[model samples]
Target: MESLVGLVVCSLLLAVQGLYSPSDDVVELNASNFNREVMQSDSLWLIEFYAPWCGHCQRLTPDWKKAATALKGVVKVGAVDADQHKSLGGQYGIRGFPTIKIFGANKNKPEDYQGGRTSQAIVEAALSGVRSLVKDRMAGKTGGSDHGWQSGGGGSGSKKDVVELTDDNFDQLVLDGEEVWLVEFFAPWCGHCKNLEPEWAAAATDIREQTKGKVRLGAVDATVHQGLSSRYGVRGFPTIKIFRKGEEPEDYSGGRSRSDIVSRALDLYSDNSPPPELLEIISEDTLKKTCEDYQLCIIAVLPHILDTGAAGRNGYLEVMMKMAEKYKKKMWGWLWTEAGAQMELESALGIGGFGYPAMAAINARKMKFALLKGSFSETGIHEFLRDLSMGRGSTATVGGGALPKIYTVQPWDGKDGELPTEDDIDLSDVELDDLERDEL
Candidate 1:
């Protein structure tokens, strides 16, 4: 039994190792030797960027090794463990696992390999790249220009979004600043740093536009600012770190694509923003201000105090508050009014026909509104808002194609409603005995 268990463990270990290690013909590339082994070589190269934890990368291991062995002397085949060496992978903008690139005569600008994952398909693509390189050489074109991939300052025409950081300004701009920053420490002469320049710049522009400068991107020249580099423990060509006020700097391990960086920046922005306030619609100004200030305004017409009382009404408000927190990233407005409090607003939104506890989403800019047909629970409201956000819900133009006339009203007093008392009539002066005598 002991021998059997040992054998099974050894087999499992072998299987795991096979996913990361290819055949001898395939060269293992890392941050230290990638530039020397592939970039400076005259031979055509095919490299795969992959993560060991990815199932797809493991499935492609056998075919990759076979193709490498077949093209041993003709073309160079290499693979990089992108998860382990993130700086190298970020330089190349490796967004997904099992991504392959073809490096031809123009080593700086590599073309993405879109062929099949089989050995035959990979070999054919590599051969085609080799033929194209030979033809270019025969035509006296070296194809070594750096303009193919590098763009000047985010491709935004002179207005750069990425800030330049130095030792003198790093503390003031990043550590003490009120905004979030994703800073890259890089050297000018490094090949990997050059590759990451365009991606970094583009991401900076997108993040700035999305967050309105609440989150920023910056870069520091590690070779020039040794003090800052050493402080951040920057030993690589391009190391990205996230900095927020009163927080410890953390390494950025996400993909280097523009979308990846933008996604992370937006998440940070949402975390820093407070949730939308749930306001009571007490006056015309309250209704107008909340609706016009946001892209979408969600209004809930809660049940009358006589019907739901304080506890039931509070339950409904709690649901709305949770929904508001869930979609706070959308930056929408949340408002509520008691039933019959705003008759004009209800008529314009067509809310009374559906009874109390109804909801509607209004787009003030477009003058359109969509009513919720689902229950008032959390799951129901979530589905309703999700569909509306995706443009799946039916919408109608607001009545008269404009905001309805709002009326000023007193706010809810947070108590059960009471019936008005009737005045007692003084009928004691009437003579009931005289009427009885007349009848007799």
Candidate 2:
């Protein structure tokens, strides 16, 4: 029996090791050799910028190592402790604790790692990046200078609004500046850069006026600024990076049109605002006004619990606030009401028939709504909204084809229920004498 128990213990230990073991093949990179090991290497590299104290990094550590072990030879997996190697982290514009970057053939322009944290997901993304690198290389040798990615290989000349950045001025103007910058890294002979010239100039002008200089747009001549080009890993003709004051730069992977750039800039510039207001749908006026004000409105019908008092309402509101913050970039409106408080709205949404913590997104103009079928927590709400943004979430006509009549209730004062002060007891007259007699 003792031998059997020992055997079971050993098996459990092995299971734990299987799940958490670090890969011996995962290269540990630091400031000292980052350039030699990653930027100049012939192999494709996926590097994770991590901090020892980050909870997410800790959770991802095992999976990252497992992915490294799986992709040992085909691709190189590496990690950098951003906390310890601050200079290297800053150079890459790593603002977050655990950012992953994919370095392909064009070692200068690494793609952001935005996939799932699972080993399988990481491996898939790495393979995809490698494939893209291979395709770009196979496209041709000197074609980048002749045809580029677009028609005109030469620029249409410089514009005034778009700041001209060179290696000498880039650091002073962008990397070390107080303002946020959206910079385009481009080769002057590249056709795509030439095409982007007009759009970029227009966006710069609009962004400057709208943001009042809080966000600026700049351009780098990759051919001239060899140092900056190599440092940023700019393998492509036109690459964009967003540099916020004192933060690591983020790759701008959004659409390249003028409107898209302006929209994304506004989103980033408004990053300091409070999470979109999570208002209570007290009356018809409030509901109508909120829906009209924002392009999309997320409404939640939460539990009404006077027994647990305002604490329950506050807890639900907290969840909404967090979700709102996570999606602040979308500029969506967040509103909530107690379950059963807005009966007409609830019926329209088909909520009370289900349960508390039900959520729906409304495009008031379209008179369409999408129900949230998943958990109402942060991740679930994020997934739902992401689908909606991508035009994937299914929508139905709002019941009644109009906004529901919402009645007002006492807004939560955000405090626990109070006990009424009792009148001074008659025991004030008799309690003292009884206690003295009993003691005697």
Candidate 3:
């Protein structure tokens, strides 16, 4: 009996290890085939909603891939990048990182499990939640979809819950001046945006509850924040985005849920301080060590040029300063040390261009980083510095022009919700008489 028991134990251990193999694990879903492949899939659907900048999403990818390949005949696994399909992510109210949604014809209700970025926990989700749903279907009880999985979240659409809001004091009322301004990208004519006003107000109000006047909430007419609406890629009705202190005014273009917006804001803005570390350059010796240790260096130009005499700069700077203070350990801010002459060092770092007024982001010494170009103002610089001190400089949007490429820190980002705002638009793109006549 003792010899037989030992054999059984070894066999079970092998099965667990076998489950970690990573062959044929993940699939990409786009606008054309989402419904056919997922919503209407014959087998169960386990979709991971994530953003590339989110570190948590990065770590989860490998573990999830392992789990996905292991499931094989048991379940179908897929992924949805919220940064690409803001609309889809919005539909799901996915606020943070590594949101795993399971779809099947059962009644599991897809409960959100905040296991973060752990390999075992993610795999276990399938073994416990998904597999259990499958078992229940084998029994007599019914009502799950033919491809029924489950739905998570309680609030969908809008409720009567409202807040007092208007255009006059809107910016001050909503934006708490975390120093950087995160505003909604919206057009007045959109029904979805209009319906979101109440919720948006409620979201801003909720932010003030704990922030104690640290951050500010506001919105802009995508009809006017310029080609900015296009650069940021506002393909949908309501989009929200984060404006680094001293950065240009870019509204959200990615399709994301209200809850996601609110939750992300609370998390990102939870600590309001300007970033000062970004303004100082690293010593030649320290720079070598940093390169060796991190293998990558990401630099942000920020809004040093455009925002100087502009409207949005002051607010953005405060945020950056706060970030600087927080990440003093691994961050350096490289701006033009001399104003009149071109900064050769910054230019060499960027290849024939000055790294002025842009976010220079690098990774693992892979030598790929982005120049977040926009305007900047002096006061905006002050505010931007304030936020950086607190150590947070990130925002995400999806479902339009590709999202800003950034890295994630954790395997699972946290959660919360956001409210949508309406933009007042000038119908210059269309003719009034023609609009009334109806081309159709």
Best by lDDT: 1
Candidate 1, which ten residues in sequence have the lowest lDDT sum? 149-158
For candidate 2, what is the TM-score? 0.46
Instruction: For residues 12-116, write the lDDT of model 1, one tens digit per residue.
Output: 433453344543688998766776687668999999998774678888988999999999999999998886666556556676788999988766567899999
Candidate 3 local distance difference test against the native? 0.48
TM-score of each: 0.55, 0.46, 0.32
Q: In terms of TM-score, which candidate is strongest?
A: 1
What's the best-to-worst order under TM-score? 1, 2, 3
Better of 1 and 2 by TM-score: 1
Which portions of model 2 miss their true places by more than 4 Å?
1-179, 184-196, 205-214, 219-241, 248-274, 283-285, 378-395, 408-410, 418-440
- Model 2 whole-model lDDT (C-alpha atoms): 0.75
**Pick by lDDT: 1 or 2, better one:** 1
Candidate models: Cα lDDT each: 0.81, 0.75, 0.48
Q: How close is candidate 3 to the true structure, as a TM-score?
A: 0.32
Question: What is the lDDT, from 0 to 100, of the residue 187 in candidate 2?
Answer: 77
Which 10 successive residues of model 3 have the least lDDT summed?
Answer: 145-154
